[model samples]
Target: MIIELIVCFFATVSFGIIFSVPRNSLLLGGGIGSLAWAIYRLLPEYGVTSIFATSIASITAAMLAHFLARKYRIPATAFTIPGIIPLVPGSKAYYTMLAFVEGDYIGGLELGIVTMLQAGAIAAGIVFALAVFSFGKGIGHRYEGGR
Candidate 1:
């Protein structure tokens, strides 16, 4: 588990470096990635399914991304994209495609569906997080005019 967290940090930092993310934000991005990954890994031990775990982690990533962006004045995506790198279901997608190539149509179909659902879950989680953050930010404020 410790190794996994370490790997998550390095992986995110590497991603930040590769993408030319601003130098000052790399450490925080790596931290968000590690924290998101930690939540994803720990929830499974408590009986949560992978899809749900992924969603929760994604939500966490987005929340941190927002905070990081606000605090540092960097675009939230600088953190969000790197933060979710470790959460991508690359293996499942690869296996799904491999199943298709190997002439296992039924297996491929099942794997493909699951892969899509997982991907959708990640998107949904991010969207939900954005909505929650937006709502929170808008509290005690009113839109007065439509222009």
Candidate 2:
């Protein structure tokens, strides 16, 4: 857990750097990314599926992004985009393609399905959070994470 935390924290910071996230927001964005990745890592040990885990973690990331965006007056994408880097299923996608190259059609298909589900879950979760927050803001909630 410690290693995963540290590695993801730095990885998120590096992603922020590469993406040119604002200097004032970079570390906070890294923090959101690290927290989201930690949630993704933790849920699997409890027997939760990766797709569910990814969705939950992504929801958490998006909510945090919205909260922090209002707090700091920065655009939420600065946090949301970098925050999801660690949750991306890069290795799974790679192996899915590799299986096809190795003539393992069934294996490739299974992996491809799971990978797509995880990706969809991430998108759905982010969108759900966005819609919720947008609705609240539109109604003049003024709920800036407790002001």
lDDT of 2 by residue, 1-147 (tens): 888888898999999999999998889988999999989989999999989999999999999998899899999998998898888999999999999999999999999999999999889889988998888555664568856
For model 2, name the residue pairs that clash: none
Q: Write the per-residue lDDT of candidate 1 for residues 1-147, one digit (tens) a residue.
A: 999999889999999899998898899999989998999899999999988999999989998898879888888888888888888889999999999999999999999988888888789877887787677676667677883
Model 1, C-alpha of 130: deviation from truth (Å): 1.5
Misplaced by over 4 Å in model 1 are 136-147
lDDT, residue 62, candidate 2: 91
Ten-residue stretch with the least lDDT total in model 1: 133-142
List ranges where model 2 is wrong by over 4 Å: 136-147
Model 1 residue 55 distance off true place after TM-score fit, in angstroms: 0.3
TM-score of each: 0.89, 0.91
